[model samples]
Structures are given as structure tokens and as C-alpha cells.
Target: MMKMWRVGLDEAGRGPCLGPLVVGLCAVPINDVALLVEAGVKDSKDLSIKKRRELVDWYKQQMDSREWKYVVNICSPQRIDAALSKDGLNILEVDLFAECLNSLSQQLSENVSILADACDVNPQRFTDRIIARIRNWPWQQSEMDSIHKADSIDPVVGMSSIFAKVTRDEMIEEISQQVGFSVGSGYPSDPNTQKILGRLVTSPLPHSELRWSWATIKNKWMEKYETPPPIRNESINVQKTLF
Candidate 1:
């Protein structure tokens, strides 16, 4: 018989300074997977936040029917740094994927195929890294692989992306409330995120929750301690989002 199953895998909070990295993999039969996609499913980025949310509920309904199941592996920032330092990010990511898929294998047995959003768009040595990483993990399925642009290509990945993004957005909103500002997406390029960092950098605050290794963070820290030459905008400008 032709191979007849599908899986969608994705990660959330990859760039966040706070919270865990949630890696999720969901599987559906190829037939139903296509049915779900044919119902106007697409990548998370292609839909509005509200639509993505609606899809999450619908996808959850599909899952609740026992037609599929998902696993969300949550790992803290410290854990990610430790693993990345041990063998670099790509390998560590594959290691995480291996762990998750290995668990999924016991349920699906040896017949299913696994597809993942390849961490690097153009992988060089990652293939070897993935091959080696899965060997020790429990997902002993003989055929799991990573492909570039998996999200754009795989309907499974599109669904998985919805779960990942929704989960991350909820966490971001919670964190914003806790921190008392619209810190934005927690990415370096986000101006609101930068503004929040500026406040923390200027105040006598400790680097308690921040990702200290970000280039922007490192540069700001150096400027604070070393007393670098004053720039045009030395003062912190934290844009308060009035609720």
C-alpha cells in the first residue's frame, strides 16, 4: 500500500526572551488532512489573527474526533541555550524534534512518515545532524526527515503553524500584561520590543528575564556600563500602551 499518513510540525517562541519553546507535531490521515486543507486552510501567516484562532478551534475539533493528535514540547530558554551551546542551534533543534517524534512513533508504529519545517532554509550539515540525533530518541520510525519550506509546501505544516502561532501569541499577550507594556513580538527588529529593553537598560533593573545574548541587548549593556559616546537619542523612550 502507498504511504498513507500525514504529520505537521512547528515550533513557537523561538525568538522570545521569555517563556518556553513549544514544539508541536500533529498527525492526520492523508485523506482527512487534504479535506481539512481543501476547506480553505493555509499557513498561519496567510490568515488574520482571528481566522488563525478560528482554525485552531476547528483543528482541535478534528483532533478531538480522534482523527489526529498533537504533542507540544515546552522547553525553557535556559534549556535551549544549554542544548544549543552543546551542539549548535540546528543540531539542537533536530534533537528536540527527534525527542518529540520518537514519542509519537510508539503510537503510529513504523509505517508513518514525519515531516518537519527544516530549521535552516538551506541546510548543509543538518541532514547528518538529524540522522544522528533521532537514533537515540524513541521515535524509531525509519522514515522521518526535514525539508526546507515545509510550512509553505505541506498542508500539515500549515495547520501546525496555526497551533504554534496561536500558542505564542497568547503567551506574548500574557507577558505584556505582566511586564506592563506592549513589548511586541519580542524580536530585535520590533520597535516596541526595543523600547521595553531601553527602559530596562536605563533603569537600575537587573537582566532577570531578558535574553542577555541578543546583539541589541549586548550592545545596550556595553553602552550602559562602558559609558559609550552619547548618541542622538540617549534617553529611553518607552511607549506606554494605554489600555
Candidate 2:
């Protein structure tokens, strides 16, 4: 007994120093998923900004005609901070997935299958949590399953990833302006990100935005910087992949 519908879920912007973590779940009719795949849908990270934007426009037009259902939730940095304070990142992410699935359960179809890209180290646990959240719905077992790379593997999830990434990146760029800094890629690895952080740890300017607990931010700030910009790595392509 196979359900007739297929759902796609993916998230974006999990590694930014600013903005939010966007978790999106979209249901693409089984018949339309292949069409989206043919229309150039792939993992959001693998697509160019211009191409992703164009694909989004095309996807929206098609969705409107066919009546697709998708939900995008932006979990702001503030929300992450609050959740981290309450229950570590792993549990917090589990909770967020539950929230998303709960929303989808309300609009589920009889022949539904869900695809979600793995966000945590343990994909099984993530899937179990989501399944548990919707256990009371009496939906078939095919209703949901979490994949390690659902976005790139499934066209519908890929489309959601593209939207989530573009939207989150825009918000991060806006934050960069307000803070008056280059703001690296929001991830802690880049030297530019460390530069902003090193100065903060030295000068100590009430860094509510920085994730002080992260090892990268914490360890880098401990180092003594010899240059102003801190010698950026030309190889790093945060600008290209994300924004």
C-alpha cells in the first residue's frame, strides 16, 4: 500500500555567524518531482546565485499552477541561542525537525513520503524523532524517511534548499552592513570571521551576536593577530557558494 504523495524537506544557513537557520519542508506531487529535476534543480550549494534565483521563479510559477505545499521556517540566531541555552544544539535541531513535521502532518496526503537531508551527526536519531512526532497521525510508514543528502538526491528538497539558502544569505548580508564588517561566511573557519572575533575578544565589545561557545571562535580569539585583516585565504570561496 503505497501513498500517492511525496514530500521533500531540506534546510539552509546552518553555519552562519549571523542570521537564521532555515528548515524547509516541501511536498512535490510525485508526477511533478521529475519535472523539477529536469528544470535544473540540484543541491542549493551546487548552483550559482543567478541560476538558483531563476530556478526559483520558474518553480514558483509551476507551483502556483499545480498548487504545491511547502513550509519554510527561519530559526533566527537568537532562537538558536535560546534553544542552545535550554537544550544543546543536537536536541534543539531535533526539536526543530519535529516542529516542521508537525506542520506537514496536518496537510499530509495518503500516499506521502518525506525526504529530509541529514543535519545532525546521527541521521537515524533525527528520523526517529520526526517519526515519533507524527506517530499519532495514523499515516502509513511511507509517510516519512530522512535521507543523508535529500536535497541533492531529491529534486523537490533541492528546490527548497535553494530557496532557504538564498533567503538566509540575503538576511546575513544585511546584518553584515549594520555591523560594519566583512563578516566572513558566518562560519567560524574563515580568517575574516576570526578577525572580527579576535578584535571582539581583545576589545570585548559586548558580543551577543558571536557564538562564543564554538571552538573556532573561542580558539582563534585566543591567538595574537599580526595584521589588520588577518591574512585572508584566497582559496576560501564563502562568497561564491553562499551569497
Candidate 3:
């Protein structure tokens, strides 16, 4: 029998007002799908920080053994801003997810099954958009679905989330190191993030890692600098929803 591949895709830092949007892809042989669940893989959001860190390490070891394969694409704040300025978040995600799929497809054989955590409110629409962007389809008898909360529903997507979450956290730490202070989780509700924003906005130039297009940052910039923060010209209409 031909080996079957099961793939999952998810993203981290989508809601954060800072940091890059990191998309993760994880794949394993269909029969080995149980291995992920047996190894306690679940949505990163449901895992504790220590647990998530531990799983990330374990996953790296497994990938090294060729037990499975994975890929990650980190979309920087600047690129994200540019995307938002044009087509919007949905298009950005579709493009990025397709990019990751293309990379993964290069490594796999036929009969691949892919499940993606939906970036759009309409799951089928999101799936269709991604499929439309993929350069290779039906080339390998592949099937794909994008659904809301796939990370929680599918172990593979949960594993993908673990990768994305850990990677984004490390990136945030690097940004903190560069800034010489902690930027917190980069979420708007994070007090440390809010505090850092206050300090960062006073600077004559915007922070490179900060998402200036975010309303949070724009408001802060306007409040402190007494002028609208420079953002891309949004010439195209898109879904008004931010997340």
C-alpha cells in the first residue's frame, strides 16, 4: 500500500499587535497520526508554557529522526502591513498557507490530506482561497480542508500550533533583547505590551517590530505624536474584521 501523508497548518501571533505572523505546517504518515496524540500533542493554547516548551523540544527530536516533517513561514510586520494595505488578512493568510503547502508538497508523495486552521470566518471560503493559490494540486491526489479551531479538533494542527506559538515567542524574546526591554506577549491586552507601547511611541521613528497598522499602535502614535501614524494606503476594500 502507498504511504499516506497527513498535514496540518496553523498560525500564531495573528491577534498580537506586535511581532510577525508565524504560520506552521506539520506532517506525518497517516498511520502515525496516533503517535502525535499519544505524545500528548494538543492545541498550544491549551498547553501550559512549560508543557508547550517541552513539546517543542520533543517535536524537534522527532523531526530530526525523520518521523515527520514540518515547515514554518514567518511573515514580518512590514510584510503584513503591506498585505493589509492591499488585499487584507484573508489574502495574506491564503498566500502564506499556500506557500507553506507548496514547500511541504515538494517533500511528500501522493495521497496527502491537509487540514488548516481557518483564517477567515467562512471556513470553506478560506479553504477554497488557499487551494486556488497552491501551485501544485491534484498532482498528488491531495485533499484539504480549512476549518475554524482545527488546532483543537486535529492533533496535527495542534502540533503545528505548538511550532508556531513557540517560534513566535522566541521571536518576541529576540525583539525584547534588541529593544533592551521586555515587550511582553505583544498582545494588546498584555500590560507589558501596553507599557512598552507607551515608551516606544515617544520615539521619533516607529519600532521595526511594531505593527503600526494596528489601531492600538495608531492610537498610541496619534496620542503621543499628535499626528496619525504613517500606514500603508489601503486602496482596496476587504473584510473589516481585523482578526
Best by lDDT: 3
The RMSD (Cα, Å) of candidate 1 is 7.9
Tens digits of per-residue lDDT, candidate 3, 25-131, equal 98888888888899899999999888889987887787756568888888888877888777988899898898888787666746889999999989999999888
Q: lDDT tens digits, residues 151-175, model 1?
A: 7788787777777778768767876
Clashes of each: 1, 4, 0
Top TM-score prediction, candidate number? 3
Better of 2 and 3 by lDDT: 3
RMSD of 2: 7.7
Better of 1 and 3 by lDDT: 3
Q: What is the C-alpha lDDT of each candidate?
A: 0.64, 0.66, 0.84
Q: Output the lDDT of residue 10, model 1.
A: 73
lDDT of 2 by residue, 1-243 (tens): 442667777778666654577776667778777888788989999999899889877867876677677666667555666665566776656666666666766666456777778777788877887667664654665656677888878888898788787777776677677788767667766667656765554433225455544555445555544323222112211111110
**How much lDDT does candidate 3 score?**
0.84
What's the distance in Å from true for residue 217, model 3? 0.5
Instruction: Write the candidate numbers in order of decreasing TM-score.
Output: 3, 1, 2
